[model samples]
Target: MTSHNTFHKVVVLGGGYAGTLAANRLRTRDDVAVTLVNPRPEFVERIRLHQFAARTGDATINYRTLLGKGIELVVDSATRIDANTRTVRLASGRALEYDYVIYAVGSTGEPPASVPGAVEHAVSIAEFESARRLRARLDALPLDAPVTVVGGGLTGIETAAELVERGRAVTLVCGRALAPTFSASGRRYIATWLSRHGVSVLRPAAVSEVRQDAVVLADGGVRPSALTVWTAGFGVPDLAAASGLRTDALGRLLTDETLTSVDDDRIVAAGDAAAPSGQPLRMSGYAAGPLGARAADTVVSRIAGTEPAVIDLAFTGACVSLGRRAGIRQLARKDDTAVNLYIGGRMGAAIKEVTCRFVVAKRIRREADKPGSMSWPKGGPRPAGTVSPAETASSAGEVASP
Candidate 1:
């Protein structure tokens, strides 16, 4: 056991928005040593992944410019966390001992296996490597090739627009409606924008099977698709459950209001991988930064022998980019329900671009340069009532921001 005078060794899992900021924020305590573990050598701007896939923008930045001095970067994947032993087992067989562990593995797009041929034929835009493979595939196909985007969420809309701008013939096969998370007005705006931009918008349609070169709808109609992009559902890594820790239905670490794990106070959670109070905020970069900082604060408080603060972050809004020159920003209540107000067209596009850049360049990088300097809006109304862990696990899937 570490003595009171010994420095606290903190190991942060996943170098996404939450994990990166949490690692930097831990620097606020001189007695803490921060080590960030990630599977990649670079920080991926997940928000700009659609642009990256379309070759419209770059999405990766070398970690040298994003991580703070004295912070160790472990280029390895965490296979499991042995909480009882206070050790993290890596895929490479190396084990890391830590005084406290921060779980922030982020989220991913997982196509449902029930749909035949989806896993083999369709590509996902939820991650860096996946986007890279998508780009390569798009490069190999002719611009006029028929491309189908499945899912009507923000990610699907953004991907469809990006591909259209690259001169590809695009069809958006939305399961229910376009921009389902946005306000009614926002959805109307997206539908009109996409329709006017030469995109064939198919709504309230379900894909029964994803074939090699076509998608068979539930009604038995087939749509020709040279390439299929799946952005339907988002899911977290099973690391928490795999490690014998309690997790929500989505596999997010179960945490208290303070972001401390319900199963172990020595372990905290942040980002998309954390389900605080069993009612997690929508998995978005807008929420991830604040959650990261808060998770670090809990760790710092424990080391200082003080009471840790609970989560109080608020959701201001959600934004979706349409191609490179147009977009829409949907305002929302503190509780995340969309309001009537919104900004569309070129101005919306500019703000969307700025918000994406600020997340990494300013919010994350600044925290790395100046620890504990990041902050977010608070005073949002706390969600009332609670659901059983089993109930939460069976709830509907949550999609991260595009």
Candidate 2:
């Protein structure tokens, strides 16, 4: 057995949005040693992965410049966590002992198990390699070949829109409704916009199976397709399950509102892998970034023997692109509920672009600044926004197409 020194080591598992931000935030403290463990050396801009699949944008970030100075980067996949020993075992047989651990291993694509042939024929955009494969398939297929997209959530909607802009014959398969999380007006706006672009929307129906060249629906109907994309759901890493931490059925680490694991306060979770108390919020970069920063604060407060500060959420806006020049900009409350003021068309697309850029910029800036010493910008009036109603009545009249 190897004896390890119990240093002030802070080990962050998974270098995606949450882990990256937490590591950067904690790096400012000279007393703490920061180590980031990830399967890859570079950071993946997950929100723009759809653009990458559409062959419109790159999805790689350089860790040398993006990681905080003095933070050790461990290029390894975490396979198990031994909370009792405060050690993480890696795929490479190495073990890392930590005083504090941030479990930020994000979610993976839910395997296409329910739909026969989907696992064998359909491709997902959950990781970089999968996106690359989808792009290659798209490039080789005839330009007009039909492409069917499964799921109507943000990712599914974004993927369908991007493919439509590529001039592909696309059919979106939504089991229930489009953008179910959005307001009724927002959903109708999205549906009308999709229709205007000549993309078919199949709602109240789901794909039961996917073949190499066709998708079978639950109602004994079929749609011919050259390619199928799955974005239905997400599953968290199993490391927590192996480590004996309390987790939900989907493998998400169960945490209090403070985002600390109920089993062990020394281990905290954030981002996609975390299920906060009460209803689960939509998994987005916006939520993950703040949660990461707050997790860092929680860790710092624990070390200082002070109360953890309550995280202050601010509503900026949410932009969903229909194509390059058209989209919807839904302004939201701090909790991410849609508000009344929304903009669509070129302006909305521009705003969406800016929002994506802002997420990247925020990460870059936080990595550049010293951790623990960092604080929010001073003296700005609180932004105005409100939570979206649980149910919104729709005003069903077609608006002018963008």
Candidate 3:
């Protein structure tokens, strides 16, 4: 490692999970100067957005309390990146130079633009402002009004469950099967649990159009609702594309195994904005945090004249809340393969709560400790030629049998 005075400057953009962890890790290092740039002064606990929509008031985190001593937190969005000069242009008309940069801008929910009147009428619970808007709408709606939650993904399911617990009439509309990514057993567990909680599930039905008071289905059926929530999909911000970096069709930066931008190594992408080299994982906090931590370690290793290590996908699971006291825990292998392990009821809820608390505590610890000063474990790029299970599976599929 370089001497404290000789270490270079590092700038981390986006103070979400990935950016916050990156800044915290780098601040621990006495040699490197760290700066965190984000549009909001506070960190939004994005995973708890559903709770906020249910009027739980759980989406805010104080950056001042989370940032370490040497790390500078800049409340502004990064608008431009000059890879050639290693400079980042902020939306606030400030330019910062850095030896390394970590991009963790996260993502935004896709507005209900496809369905007419949905964008103007439906509520989204993705961002802090959106959740607040939804909460206000819920408070003003009639007690017996029907609410339709579009999409059956994790976000949609969680939102629907939370609303149901609030004594609201909820209808979950899924175009296909619910929790399609889960194992067969997990899918059954979730469907049964949701059905038992007074949530009506509509499957194999596509929303032809969304009106102010009802949604028209493909089969010429209409579902009445006073409040509609659209959680169908998410769209990453166009910052990378706007800054002239390479991005995939969905606007996610194409990243290699090391989480480095395919177009520019000086700029690394993480969190929801990064697409894995071969096997692209779903955009979730479970994956984003590790990717962010790995990206930070990669930048540090490069500066320390050591080769960057490849990421090891060890912990991959899905924990969904059915309500305040019930949840479903679906386990998965390192290769992103789902297993038939389901945890539900009160015990599952406790597990889910603990998991969320662990994430928060982990961030707190990282911020308190900082980066380079701590002695991190050492391992090679590929773990002595033994590829990760995900990599091995992909390689085997690519080989031609004799």
Task: Return the top candidate by lDDT.
Answer: 1
Which candidate, 1 or 2, has the higher TM-score?
1
Supply the TM-score for candidate 1.
Answer: 0.95
Ranking by TM-score: 1, 3, 2
Q: For model 2, how does the per-residue alpha-carbon lDDT over 1-402 read when each residue is reduced to its tens digit?
A: 222343368899988877888888885556778899999988998878888999888898898867878789999999888888889999999999988888899878844676789889999988888888999999999989999999888788889999898888999999878987677788888999889887899998888889999999999998898999998877777888888876766667766656677678788777778765523345677667777777887787777788775445554546788778888887765545667667888888898888777766756455556555433322222223211211111111100000
Scanning candidate 3 in windows of ten residues, the lowest lDDT window is 393-402
Ranking by lDDT: 1, 3, 2
Clashes of each: 1, 1, 4
Candidate 1 displacement at residue 201 in angstroms: 0.8
Residue-level lDDT of model 1, residues 1-402, one tens digit each, is 445468899999999999999999999977788899999999999999999999999999998898988899999999999988899999999999999999999998967787999999999999999999899999999889899999988899999999998789999998887887788898999889888889999889988899889999998999999999999888899999999988878888887778888778899999998887777888889999999999999999999999898889878889999999999999988877889889999999999999998998888899888999998889876544433444444333345482
Number of the top candidate by TM-score?
1
lDDT of 3 at 9: 87
Candidate 2 positional error at 196, Å = 1.8
What's the CA error at residue 62 for candidate 2, in Å? 0.8
Off by over 4 Å in 3: 1-7, 370-402
TM-score of every candidate relative to the true structure: 0.95, 0.88, 0.89
Determine the backbone clash count of candidate 2. Answer: 1
lDDT of 2 at 94: 100
